[model samples]
Target: MLALKAENISKQYRLGEVGTGTLSHDLNRFWHKVRGKEDPYFKIGEANDRSSKGNSDYVWSLRDINFEIEQGDAVGIIGKNGAGKSTLLKLLSKVTKPTTGKIFTNGRIASLLEVGTGFHPEMTGRENVFLNGAILGMTRKEIKRKFDEIVDFSGVERYIDTPVKRYSSGMYVRLAFAVAAHLESEILIVDEVLAVGDAEFQKKCLGKMGDVTKGEGRTILFVSHNLPSILQLCKKGILLEHGLLKESADISTIISMYTHNAESEDIIPNSNKDVYLKSFKSYTEDDLESNLQTAKNGVLEFNIYSNKNLKNVKIGIGFNDDMGNRLFTPFSGHFQKMFDLSIGENTIYCTLDNFPLKSGKYTCEIYIGDNTETLDYYDKGLIVNVKDNFTLEKPDYSQGYFIINQKWTNERK
Candidate 1:
């Protein structure tokens, strides 16, 4: 069943001043309306490309977007900044109207698009919960029935009676999410506002969203820059580029396309005459290139060219998934080790014993520096692909990203 559908949706905004300009564009539009013809400015509007300057005053934040989301399906809307991600969410949430086309939805929508979106700053948290519930078409009886659960989930019981204006940003999001998730809204819309929360709180929110979709059978539209979270929570993906709907497909395919096209490996040069990264590579136990396969014992090696001898240098490596979501970062300082760089060249190697990463493509980020300043940094320096071996049968990617070696014991009663 289709829970939501958007047809030829587009939103346009002026570049600088509001109201179409100094009465010229407005008069032009009015003249077109009087003649029963299409607006002339519509044809002159340009795409919302933030990187380049356009000649037109009006830009389309979203243009000709068409998609259908099935009931109980979680869809992730992903794109670079100023790619019209938030604009689409706002259009769907009715925060703003599209300049053209229409949207149809089957059920009530509760959106947590931003911090304190529907909150009244002067109202108490307890009052705001009832107000938001009422706005979502819930009766007072229903609000009261779920009030305790919402307060408990938010973890702001002590501040429930206090005015929300005094609450912190984290507190605002907690209460907003609790109300949006717990209330009887068949569809939920969440933007990148979740990035404001801490890591543990974000995990908890993701778990709650999972429950909402899988356990309660609700529809969700999530917009985020965090690719791992999108991959973990959504089954479908919609990619937008410069206000246009680029692709809509299964999550994995969309992720692959997005990552491959956006992949970059540029080494940043430092101003100081210190150490700089020259090359980085990974090798398997067989001394073969680790681009495809690596044995249990693999080595990540890098070379640094230095102008002068240095001591107490810090080196760090970050492992990220294809979509540029960092999984883990290991630093030399964390191991209580100091690095010394010779004047000409220096080599550093990190060994992976019994590499636990599952079969997948990963990117490596390299950083070389000291406590005071950074010498060199490379984003997506090297690409490593881990292949599945005969070590395990039927590996599960959903259980976790990596395979943990652990002993299992059974007690028979």
Candidate 2:
């Protein structure tokens, strides 16, 4: 059975200022409505590309997006930062109406789109739990039954009676998620609310969500930037780009496409005024540029383009899996090494030794700093691909991120 379905849904917003700045445009829409004709501005909406300005005054935040999610299935929504992710959630949650489409859902929905989304700040956490439960059409008896479970899961028992306005952001998300998850809603919508919580709490929340879907067989729609969490929780995934539904598939395939799109952009912003990074590259042992993927043992070189330089410069690079987990970071300070550069140009090199990390695409961060301050930093400066030079028999070898270097030997079983 289908739990939710969006049909030809689209949301359009007027550029600059609010709603049809001129009376003429407003009158035109009314005239069309009166004549039972299409609105004059309906066809003028441009695609939502924030990189450049458009000629039209209207742009579609989401255009003709269609998908259906089944009951008892968890679906993950993945997209860029401004890819209408929140907009779609808002539309589904009934916080706003679509400009031109319909969304169908089979059961009651409880949403925690943001911190304290459906919460009243002045109300105590205890009262808010009941209030949210009531809003979800739960009886006071039902809420009372789940009250202890909710408080235990949130780990905010001490502050349950305190007014939520005084609670920190993390506390707000904790209690809010607790209520949403424990309530008797058939479909739950969560939108990156776990990000505000601590790492331990985030892990707890993911575990609870897994139980909600797998054990109790509830439908869940989750939006998050944490790729690993999404992979663990959701079986199906959808990718959105510039307000359009680009791809829908299993979680792994969707993530692969999304990362490829991001890497293709190759965006490295130079926020440093003094020293700028011209190029960051990985090379083979024989000295060849291998940016995409290379063997475990290779060289990572950074070419610095500077107007002027000084002494005691420190550099470092960090490697992270796609899920934002830091595998390892090597800093020059580890070896008590520093460099002195000339006036116009500089080059820095970092080498790897038998790095048998599992074969997959990884992202690296480059930073240049002095003892006192940082001269340049790129969060995702480059994408490093590690190839599996030594293939193993087991499939888990391909899935593992880190390789064991120790040799295995045994006399008998």
Give me the candidate number with maximum TM-score.
2
Give per-residue CA lDDT, model 2, range 1-413, as digits (tens).
Answer: 99999999998888785755578888888899999999877788788888888888888899999999999998999988778888999999888899888999998899999999889999999999999999999999999999999999999999999999999999999999999999989999999878889879988988988999999989998998766778778999989999999998988888788877565235444635688666776655664754323335667777876767688888898888766578888899888899886776687888876665677777667788889998887753255666655555533655567765566677655
User: What range of 10 consecutive residues in model 1 has the weakest lDDT sum?
Assistant: 262-271
Clash counts per candidate, in order, are 0, 0
* lDDT of each residue in 317-362, candidate 1, tens digit only: 8888755578887788888777988897788887777677777767
> Once model 1 is optimally superposed onto the true structure by TM-score, how far is the C-alpha of residue 308 displaced, in angstroms?
20
**Which portions of model 2 miss their true places by more than 4 Å?**
19-24, 264-289, 292-296, 299-349, 362-384, 388-413
Q: Alpha carbon lDDT of residue 33, candidate 2? A: 96
Error of 1 at 322 (Å): 8.5
Q: Scored by Cα lDDT, where does model 2 land? A: 0.82
